[model samples]
Target: MTVAPGPADHAELQRQLPGLGQAPGPVDAAVPAAHALLVHPRARQAIVLGGLNIGYELVRVRRRSIGMVVTAEGLSVRAPRWVGLGDIEAALQAKARWLLGKLGEQGERQRRLAAGRIDWVDGACLPYLGETLVLRLDPQQRGLALREAAAGDTPPGRRLLLGLPPQADAVQVRDAVQSWLMKEARRVFLERLAHYAPTLGVQVRRLALSSAQTRWGSASADGSIRLNWRLIHFSLATLDYVVVHELAHLRHMDHSPRFWDVVRDVLPDFDQARAALRDPVLPAFD
Candidate 1:
C-alpha cells in the first residue's frame, strides 16, 4: 500500500462534489423515493452522480490508486492516504455506470443466494452437479447418500437421503451433506488431475481439498495442487477447466499468455467454463 498525491484533505473532496454549497431542495412525496434510488439501502456513504444518488462505503488506506470493489456486500471504495475526498468522489462519478451495474449485479447475487438456500428438511431440494436433487430422511445406518429419483416421478432427477430423521437440525443436515460432497470432490479432482497431467506432460504429486472462500484452485511449484471442494457442485466441464488451469500453472508458474496457450491445448472452450465458474450462486453454509 503505497501513498500517492491527492487533494489536500476531506474539505477539498467535499468542495469538488457537484453540489456542495447549493441550497437544499423541498421535501416532497417523491423526495425520499428519488433519493432512495441514488443510495444503496445499506451503504455508509452517499454521493451524487449525474444528479442521482449513489451510495458506497469509503475505506481510506495507504494504496496507490483509488480502487473500487463491488461484492456481495456492495460497492466499496479504497483510496490512498494522500488522496483527498474530492479526488475519490471524482473517480466515483467517472465510474458511475460501472458502479451502478455492479451494484445491480450484487443485488441479483443476493437474491439468488436467498432463493438457492437449502431448507435442510425433508423434501428439500438442493443443487448437485448442475442439477437439482431432493433431500429425504433415510436414517438407516448408511447415514448420508444420494439415490436416483423414483422411476416415472414428475421431476425426474436424483434424491439425496440423509440418515438423520425429519426432525434433524440444519447444522446436522448441512455438515452431513458437505462431508459427502467433499469426499466426491477429492475422488473427482484426482481423476481429472490424472487425466490432464499426462496430456499437459506435467506430473502432479498430490491433490488437497481446500475450503478456501475465494480461491478455486492453486498449483505449487512442488507439483502439489489444492482445489476448492465446493467445485463438486458444478458440472464436470467446470471442474476440468479448474483442473487444467492449475496444471498449466505447473508448467509456467505464472498467468502469462504462454501458460494460457498450454491450457488451450487441453481445453479449447476454456472461456465458457471460466465464466461459468464465476457466476453461479452456491448454497449458504456457515
Candidate 2:
C-alpha cells in the first residue's frame, strides 16, 4: 500500500498514482461505515452506492470509460460526457470493495497529518532532534535560545525560548520559530557534511538549505548539496540519513548497488535512520 499527501481543498486533488486508481471488483457489503459525508464542491451528482456513506464527485469528461480516483478529499469519478448518472453509479457499485479500502487508508493518513500540524502559539510543543520542546513566547529574549525545564528534581522536557510576544498570533510565532529552525538546519547540515565528506572520499563544493515541498534532499552532479530545512524537526540520526545520502551521490550518481555500499560504509545504521523520517508525523507548516 502507498500513502499520498492530503488534498489541499475539496477540489484541489489530482490523480498521481497509476494503479491505485484502477480497482476491479464486484460490489461487496464490506465497506466501512462512514461518519460524515465527503463531497467535492464541484460535484454534479451524489450517491451512496456502496456501504460507505461518503458521496463521490461525479465529473463528466471526454473519456470512454469511467475512472475513479481516491484522494484525501474523498472519491472522484471521471466518465464520458455521454455516460448517464445510472451508469456511473453502477460502475462505482462494481468497484465498491476496492474503493472503500483505499478511501479508509487515505482518510486515516489525512487525520494523522492534520493532528501533526503545529498550532504555533505560546505553550505549543514540537519535536526537536527527537526530543520534546515546549514553545515559550519570550519577546524580550535577545536571540533564539533553548533552556532546560526541571520540574522539581525531574526534567520532563526542554523549552525553546523564542523572541515573540505572549499574545503573538499563529503566523508571527510560526515565522519566528521557522526562521530559527532554518538557521539551525544550515549550521547542522554543514557539520554533518564536513564529518562524512572526507571519509567518503568526496569534496563538497557547497551546501545549501532547500524548502522543497516533496523532496528531502538532493545531490547535483556538481559537488553541491541541498537539504530541506524541515529536516531539523527530526532526530540527528534521521537528519544524517539525508545528509549522508546526498553525499554518497558524489561517489555514485544513481541508486545502483554501489550507492548503497557507499552509504553503508560510513553510516552503518543508515537504514534505521531512514525509517525515522516516516515514523514521525511532521508538523504541518500551513
Candidate 3:
C-alpha cells in the first residue's frame, strides 16, 4: 500500500487507479454490501484490503496507475486518498466477476510468454521483425555473432549458420537478441522521426521506450514519445507507422481526422501497418 505525495501527484495517481479519484461516484446503495480482496495465483496469501472501493491494489512502484494491474508479482489496486475501507471492500465484491476474468486473461498471457521460451541452441525458432527466424548454431564458429542470410542463400546441400556461443543459455540468448533488436529499433525509429519531422514541421524533444501493456504507444504534448519496446517484434514498416502516428499527435493532440491526415501524408500505406499492429498475439506480453 503506497500513498502519493502532493496534489500535483493526484492526476498521476488517478491514472494508475482508474475510477478511484474521478470515479463515477459510488454505486447505488442497493448494490449490496460485500468484502473484496485481490487474489493472485502467484501470491502465497490473499492480499490484505487497504481502501474502500471496487479497485484492486497493485504493488509495482514503476506502475504509475492505480487501477488493477496483473503482474508476475500478483494483482494490485490503486485506491484514492479519500476512499473508505468499507466502501473499497464493497466495490471489490461488486466487481469480483470482472476482476476474476481479468486475472484469468493475465494468467494465460503469462503462460504463453513463458511457453514461447527459446532453447538458444541450433534449430530454435524465434520471432524477429514480425517473422520467425530459425537459429542455426555452428559450434565451429569462433565467437558470438548474428548473421542474416537469405532463406535460399545456403549452399545447395548446406544450411546457413547463425553463430551463437555454445555455452549461452536461453536467457542469455534472449537478452543478446533483444539488445540487438532494441539498438536497431532506436536507430530506425530516430531516423524515421527525423525524416517525418521536417515534413510535418514538428520537432521531437524526447523519445523513450515504454513497457506499457495496454497501450502500443503514447505521445505527450511536450513532444515526448514513448514507444513499446515489443514493437521491435513487428516489421520495420509497422514500427515506422507507429512512430508517424505518435509524431502526428505533436501537431494534433487528439485522434481527430486532421491528426490522421497528418499521418497519411507521411505514410500513405499506414493502413497496412495499422492492420498488422492489431494482431492479438502482439499484446500477449504483459
Give residue 11's error in model 1 in angstroms: 10
How high is the CA lDDT of each candidate model?
Answer: 0.76, 0.76, 0.62
Q: What TM-scores do the predictions have?
A: 0.72, 0.81, 0.52
Instruction: Kindly indicate the candidate among 1 and 2 with the higher TM-score.
Output: 2
lDDT of 1: 0.76
- Candidate 3: tens digits of C-alpha lDDT, residues 1-286: 6564556565664453445433334344443222323254444324222232323342334433335555544466555554444434444544555555555566565666666765666566656666666656666764345566656843222232445665657665555556666776677678888888888888999989877777778999999998887887788888889988998999999999999889999989888889887634642221
Q: Which stretches of candidate 2 lie over 4 Å from their true place?
A: 1-37, 152-156, 278-280
Give lDDT tens digits, candidate 1, residues 223-263. Answer: 99999998988888988999999999999999899999999
1 or 3: which has the higher TM-score? Answer: 1
Q: Weakest 10 consecutive residues, lDDT, candidate 1?
A: 27-36
Runs of candidate 3 exceeding 4 Å displacement = 1-117, 136-145, 150-164, 282-286
Q: Number of the top candidate by TM-score?
A: 2
Ten residues in sequence with the least summed lDDT for candidate 3: 45-54
State residue 215's C-alpha deviation in candidate 1, in Å.
0.7
